[model samples]
Target: MTELEYTTFGKTGLKVSKLGLGGAPLAGDFGITDEQEVQRMIHAAIDGGINFIDTAPLYGNGESERRIGQAIVDRRDRVVLATKAARSDMRYDYETTIRSVEMSLHRLQTDWIDILQIHDVESQPYELVVSETIPALEKLRQDGKIRFLGVTTRNLELLRKYMATEMFDSIQFYTRYMLLDHTAKDETIPLAKELNMGVINGSVLGMGILADAPAPFLREDIQADGLARMEQLAFLRKPGPKGLIEPAMRFSLGNPDVHVTLTGVSTLAALQTNMSYCDGNGLASEEVEKVYALFQEQPLFD
Candidate 1:
């Protein structure tokens, strides 16, 4: 196996693998997942030099964290584990925020989480998040339950709002930085760099659209627009199954502004394919310029 590259995780100072394992697929959300198989994949990820794992209680109602907890119990020290608060079932109040992390800790079977993020902030009122939710996370940090604070949202404007708060050490957004969009480069990513926050780029494959297995729930307009945009870049696809997969993964993995490019894979083969792009490779200069120019300041998903 090739050695994966590492980077300093923004202001947090922890070194993380450029390719982080995302826990959504392990929750069986994408398909039926075998617990033992999931454990093996997690171990494989650790063995392949992947030290960053991102999960959330919202992923299969805590199933992702539970499986990861079981897999990493003996090797917990080997990775930089991250999970989120604010499940879809609960309100994002201070009490709920505290309870969420507590439940996550129980499910993850860990005393401390490396990074605890406020999940999907775009769904709630910003004032509520500022006055109540963030304080709860702060309390968790002060109590030594979580090391750093972070936020995840697909809304660029809302993401910029959170970044301007300067309270978080990291920010995660998906789809915006992929081959189909690349809008994060317009502002959110640069702002994150200005804030010295770690940037975790998720859904580099556009929730499977780049791989020809587009998520069923994607808005018709997003799917249509993305597919249309993807069509113009037929030249970038490889010669294998869903040729866009490799380029999609490498597009983000090769980015200098992105600290961790998450590959949310359920199968070992998919993990290996994503890991293969960590060898310090990116698109050619001309190709990169073309992709960037294709959607300059154009938001794909509102």
Candidate 2:
């Protein structure tokens, strides 16, 4: 077993594990999840030195937060709990924003969230996020409901737009920074580093594509592209228990620019496997250069 490494989260000065536990799988978004099993996995993750956990109301309609809250209520001090608002069952209005955070607090069983992010900001109107959504988060921060502000979006362009505002303490983007798509490293990641905002890289396994189980909701074109790319990178796969998963996990874990790489696992076994990759190992310098040369500026999704 390898010891987990910690990083200073951007300018926040919050010490976060290089690997964080993501909440979608626990919410049963990926498949059927057992409540007891999920709780146990949370405990194991914390015990294994994974301090940062990310979740959102969109994941199984708050089931993720509810379960996680119940699991960590007694050990909350050991984790940097993070959850999202505005993408739940309400509009992105001021009142709804406040209501959303309050609801998350209830589900999480915590008085205050370490990080409260504006979920999928690109899906909402920019003016709404700037005028109403942000103000609501600011109010929550002032009210001691959340300690820091962050934003999540798959749209790299929109992510940069929000990062430019300088209001957020962190930024999270998925899929774009994975093996099949290295587009984020081109600008989005550099911008976040330049602004000194914590960078959370989600979907490092390309939503299970790297694990040989692509998500059902992905487009046929994306699924095909990911599979093809996976085949091309077969040489990087070391003979091990996880095969491609090992390299996939290390790809993001090894990146100095990525502060936190989120691992979405439903079972204790999966959590343990991901935890094992946190041993300060990443792809070789030559392998990284080869991947960059292969993908270059080509993005997998439109």
Candidate 3:
């Protein structure tokens, strides 16, 4: 058996590795994509002991879901497939959110979803979440369109506020070593556990930053927020250690209470490399020390 570890999704009986396959740029779903190459990577992750995969209808316009679905159709029963709806990137709310889930199921070719989330919940205000959003989420859950309903966002305050209502079964938040901003390393996670919510950590690599990436693919100078991360951050000034992608991934997988960490695998090599970290103790203390030193010397992304 592969060395990957498993945990239940929240209090549910759904068992998934601490590391789950994230389908994003790999699926090329947003526009033009390499379906064949992404498929190979998907299988590699499955074979490497990743039983959890997270995707969304908005990712590459449902491209990631379709590719992930096709890759694991035969093995669908073996995974906890999670996808999100209710994107704030558009004027979407309750009705459109339901439509998004339906479309995602059609694309994923699955009759039921293990986890269905409210995508980009923090991008909007709390009123939106309490109003058209939460009600619709409740509707979907009642309709049994999804086995569990959760919210995916980085807003700890908002998340805490929602959790106070005791409505969701799970949550998706961001947690990583390089996290300087929008990180829940403080108390959100502990509270989540106390509240009995499944916690899935997203952007585990900081969008390839921990991959010691040359800056998450540096597309263009769009929003001021992104422009700030353009290569000048102290944490990224010096390149990360020469280790493959495994060390960072393995570290995230070790966090207790983390049901899964979603990593976007771009290639077959990327998937294999990440699985290398699945062995639990992929690095010795000194090796981990070297990795930490590397982080200390660079600019941290918040």
Candidate 4:
């Protein structure tokens, strides 16, 4: 077993594992509901030297946080836990945001959250996040309820707007640094580095599309297109020393702008496979370029 690599989470100065455990799977989002299995996966991640765990209240309606609380009994201090707060209407309101954080705290069973993010900032008005939502989070930080504040979104325009404010300690977005897409490398990642905010890259595998697996979470039309694109990159699945996952995982981890790569795993096997690629070694530069050339002219979605 290779040792997992660790990095400083941007300006926060918190050392996080290069590969962090995404909490959606624990909520049984990926068709996993066995409590014992979820606990096993969480413990396995920690035992494997993965300390950064990111969860959100929207995942399975707080089931993810509840399971996380149960999993990290005496080991809470060893993990850097992160969770999100989102209004039921998917809008940003100060009162609802505050209440959401309180509920997250109770479910996580933690006095202070390591990182508290505003979920899906793109769905709400930017002024609301900047004027009301962020100020509310600042109060929580001052009250010592959350150590750091951040935001998660996949919308490029919204991300650019939030980065300009420089109010967040970290930012989570889809890097999509795979054979099919590499949009984050364009401007979002560059701006993140310039502002010195932690970059947590999600959807590194294109939400399972890069793995050539069917992702029922996606809409039918999007799923169909993803499967077609997967076929285009079928050469990567050929018998070799490395398969599609290695190159896909390494592509995101290889980027200097990415501090942590967030991957959601429902089973221990998937978690172990990902950990193997976080051993501080990524694909050679030329290999990465070759993979990118295959789909440089093609965009995964509209």
Rank candidates by lDDT, best first: 1, 2, 4, 3
Q: Which residue pairs in candidate 4 have backbone atoms (N, alpha carbon, C) closer than 3 angstroms, thus clashing?
A: none
Give TM-scores for every candidate, taking all chains together and pairing residue i with residue i.
0.98, 0.97, 0.81, 0.93
Tell me the deviation in Å of residue 195 in model 4. Answer: 1.0
Give a tens-digit lDDT track for model 2, residues 32-123: 99999998999999988999999988899889989999999999999998999878355799998999899999999999999999998877
Expressed as tens digits, the lDDT of each residue in 1-302 for candidate 4 is 76999989989999999899998778877785788888999999998899999999888889999999989877999999999987446666888888899999999888999999888886788788888899889999999999998888877668888888888899997735556677667687888888999989887777777766656767788777766766766655636533577677887887777998987887888889899889888878877666666666455654
Global lDDT of model 2: 0.90
Count clashing residue pairs per candidate. Answer: 0, 0, 9, 0
Error of 4 at 139 (Å): 0.4
Residue 234, model 3: Cα distance from true site in angstroms: 13
Query: What's the TM for model 3?
Result: 0.81
Q: Which runs of model 2 end up more than 4 angstroms from their true locations?
A: 240-242
Q: How close to the true structure is residue 80 of candidate 1, measured as C-alpha lDDT?
A: 98
Estimate, for each residue in 108-162, the C-alpha lDDT of model 3 and write its tens digit: 9888888888887767777867787778767877888788878876666677787
Q: Which lDDT values do the candidates have, in the order given?
A: 0.90, 0.90, 0.69, 0.82
Give the lDDT of residue 91 in candidate 2. Answer: 73
lDDT of 1 by residue, 1-302 (tens): 87888899999999999999999999889888888878889999998899999999989889999999998999999989999988755679999999999999999999999999999898888998999999999999999999999999998889998899899999999888998888889788889888889999998988888999889888999889888988888989899779998888888988888999999998887788789999888888888888887877787777
How big is the positional error of residue 141 in model 3, measured in Å on the Cα after superposition? Answer: 2.2
